[model samples]
Target: MRRSVISGLSAALVLTSAGVGGALLAPAASAAPASPALTTGVADGTYVSLKPTRMLDTRGSYLGRPLNAGEVYNLKVNGRGGVPSTGVSAVVLNMTVTAPTRAGNIVVYPKGSAVPNASSLNFVAKDTRANLVTVPVSSDGWVSIRNATGQTHVIADVQGYYVGSTTTKPAGAVDYFPDDPWRALDTRTAQDGPALAANDYLIQSVSYGANTANISALAVNVTAVNPQWTGFLNAWNGDENAIPNTSNLNFASRKTTSNMVIVPVTHGVGSDGTTPVLNFGIGNASPGTVDVIVDVVGVYATGDGLRFRSVGAPKRIVDTRTSLGATTLDAATTRTVTAPSTVTNSTTVALVTNATAVSPTAATYLTLWQTGVTRSAASNLNPAAGQTVANMAMVGLSDINQFDIYNNAGRTNVIVDVAGRMDLSPNLASGAAPSLSTRTAPKALGSRVATLR
Candidate 1:
């Protein structure tokens, strides 16, 4: 069995003869599209990081808060088949920008195809209660993403996905962070007023390979106001508002946590803790955009109130509407793992599904996916297919519950053994994990329960 499309986190493979083919990375536009007209030569402080935590308004709108992990709430938007993370996926990047600085949404596919097994999510939010989620159709749909506590959440919304291929170099290896500042391509590029002017846009896409090279280290795209223009930029310093780069970002497909770095800034007396106040830094960068590479978890989706999931072995991989099946692994939605010549300590887990793989369904092959999960009803609809009939660690019971592992016997390699518990319905793409109530009637797996994989 060939590896499916790839994600960032790496895993160990125990091939049980699973056959799969996935994404083909395509080159990204060297420059930002005219519609968005990415600001070029933007100042260093011009860009802002997407907030991991957000405070919701009294009416359930996101208001930017320090959302610790346990305090998050997941509310499903689309409610397709099943949610990925217990019908409650957290929004990674949370930020509110001034008017006109709209959030962006992207429907990524493998090299060459405009349309694939894709899910659309947006970043633009109108307060925290209502957000415009990008779906396949251009007709903007609104969804809820947070609660009164200002905590981000996704619940019961399900959607499937397709993935593209990633090459170690050139094609699909670059990773981007939404929370970091938007920087000029290079310091030299920063000098061009046309490219780095206030509100001047510069759109960029780096293809981190889809495999082990899936981008782990990313440059936090931060934009600083030219010390000359610092005054013009800081005018909105009251709420920490910034020129947010709502660039679409995907989670680390594999095993890793990304660290974020920030430059020293002068917190404006007029600024809330939200916006970045211009400060002196290396090179005395007096307010122009300065780009620095930083570690990141992934991007947050703004469309239909998006959802995302993190999967890895040793660390369990959850299957939701967005989960890739072993069959119909598409180029943009799949992540693949390769067997090491000499098995080392690393063990990996690839997704394999049964319900979505059958015919009459768009999904024909199992795949490896990386984009944020979907949180919409149109995405997940089927009850049986969406339910987690068998959890990941199912050793042997039903063909549908079996995991096709790669066996490199004689080689001291780590093999992933997943428990085959009953998921109300499993789909990884939505990555909206299943909730207890969502799986009210668990499937009868005949007594034995699967365990740690």
Candidate 2:
């Protein structure tokens, strides 16, 4: 069933660069009105990676039309694209919004729930943007997305899903280990050299030092800086023969964009026989060059690690515009943002949050990490002068359930939306919650542009 409201990686120690294109205009604010905090149960589950597949495209294959302003659309997520018909708790998707008529934000949540005061991504008029989203599914395996302004076409490619612990752990179930944010690649440096040329691919090894063993996949933030032409970037496990058809992020000429990517890794014994070496690839698909930055935030490994727990619909826990986390953050300053009183569970080791940078005074970036943890060189969101943008971030939390947001330059308001959290495996629960559908639609036939991996 489809309902309507309108709403809307990778590893490696190595990096590359690309060229610049056009400037992007700031989009309108997308946050819903503040509502009283609601109590939500934890959904513990293990991670499962699937062959990336295009699940929805509004242009032709799916809805066959653009979404209107303030509309909500619910798309079936489970029992398709390699996801199981039952037992799936959440899904990992790379969602793209293209040809928007006007600037607006995209909000996504579990089907049958009230719209939450948050956004999944923000975009300008006639812009093409993409962000990775991890969302919980309703009992019948569906999630709702809303487009906050103007008509836009949406595309989603499924990368993986989380299965509840109550169900038998499927083969290849991986546990997650949240690492301190670390910058593994920065192609801007002379050593890494020249921006990435169109159609060029770079392979780099990503390691977690002592924690490298048993690592199967990596959670990294991928940013395209000053892309010279309008194009997209593809990330994968470095399999030369099988490059995925999906794009990790889309960027315009000269505009900077970032997305969270969870990519499986190809492993090898390092030069030091005892250590493991994990590597992945990034390919540029544009007419010009662009710089690429990869930041490792977490790892997926077998054996012991943490499971994910859904927090129902995303919860707006921080709004800098209000007294929430102090007014707009100034350049080079950091502020502490605490979780809501409802998410005080000691089991919360990390959170899956959508962080937005609104109306930045200058082109700048924001980095998020736990309050007491040493700040990492990684950045979560990058917004051009006066541009409003959002990106998903998986951040660890301090002992007091607090985290910090640091602005790189100029003043900008920050908004944090909690989608889910990482918790101990023992806390993982089972069973599905009932949900009602809003709109019914025909099943998706196939993508207009077929790119299945």
Candidate 3:
């Protein structure tokens, strides 16, 4: 009856217990098999968008068995799905866990490396959850995933990858632009309509201001709230003919769940019917209706934007349990955590971090943003009482190199692990400003919609 998600690789990889909650498995006993030598240089830390593709689904033939406790699985990344076999430095994946037999944590690290004492996801028994992970790739084009407790099944869907930089920037590569995190859709609102009906699809326009032409993708967090039945949600580039067989977030009946989504963009007609706009589509695969909320944090575009720079591994920046940033964040309180000097050098403007709420005394959600701006109506992580949950966030950095985290409801400990940083592109055009546009309403896909049975 046990189930867990991980693929089979050579037995050379190893995983050992680190401790209790949030602690991940150890590194492999030896280095992973070496990859073919690359005559070109390393990655330049820019992104390349792709249509969503399913790379691993453990519930099916992939490994065909649940990943047991303390099991490490090396998944081949390069040359799989839409990713190139070489020249990849990192990848963006939406990771989901379902039917966990016991509560546990999931850690994702580059192949052959020691697992950092951090978790990419935390889930309880019989729960379904997903989180976005931007992981550095191993030299041999692979990454490892480990489960810390009872068996569970995992699913990984690739949305994009970062390429190596050479003397010349890779063609079609794009830079990142972090926004202040604004709400783009909420089906609960009257204007957007009621909760999404079962097996229906909705197309939502996301305004990129004047950056529409060059924008390749938008970084957004999508949440499903209080569904009438258990099921999942899928997002794509709004092309009616090419919906990927992937789910962005999963939820049980009456439960609220969220996941970060790097949705590719496509041009479409705006509300007025003639104005061109950028849009994406979300489809519900459940038997019941559910409310959907979307919040945009950033965008990917060519030229004059922030470039991504991945760290060797994710670094823990704040751990309230150890008083690293501060004591426990009390209910309705805000804490300003300064960025590490190493990641906040002159060129850096924002950080990509995994924010976790550890064993809160009561149900709560955490909101993160730059210190200078007002807190937007967006949350990065939402955890029930006594649950430890994590979600990836691209948080802007204020003038003083600081960002704020606000805890709602009861007191809880917070942990932030830095996966990468966004550096001001050296190619930024002189005097060009980067800003986010206002939120738009949702549009019914009508005859173009793909209904899931």
Best by TM-score: 3
Q: For model 1, how does the per-residue alpha-carbon lDDT over 422-442 read when each residue is reduced to its tens digit?
A: 111111222222110000111
Sliding window of 10 residues with minimal summed lDDT for model 2 = 1-10
Tens digits of per-residue lDDT for model 3, 1-453: 000000011111111000001112343322332222234433377788888877777787676767788888788888887788788889998899988999988888787788788788889898888889999988888888988888999888888898865545565577666665667788887766678888888877765444466677888899888889999998888887887888888888887777888898898766677655787888899989999998887777764456778776788889999988656899999999888885667666778888889998998889988776678878988787898888998887776678899999999999998888876555432222333333343454332335763
Report lDDT per candidate. 0.20, 0.72, 0.75
Off by over 4 Å in 1: 1-92, 95-184, 187-195, 204-345, 348-453
By lDDT, the candidates rank as 3, 2, 1
Model 2 lDDT tens row, 35-109:
212223233477888767888788865667887787777888888888888888899989899999999988877
Instruction: Please report the candidate that would top lDDT against the real structure.
Output: 3
In angstroms, how far off is 241's CA in candidate 1? 23
lDDT, model 3, position 430: 28
Candidate 1 is scored at a TM of 0.21
Decide which is better by TM-score, 1 or 3: 3
**On a 0 to 1 TM-score scale, where does candidate 3 land against the true structure?**
0.86
Task: Specify the poorest-scoring 10-residue window by lDDT in model 3.
Answer: 1-10
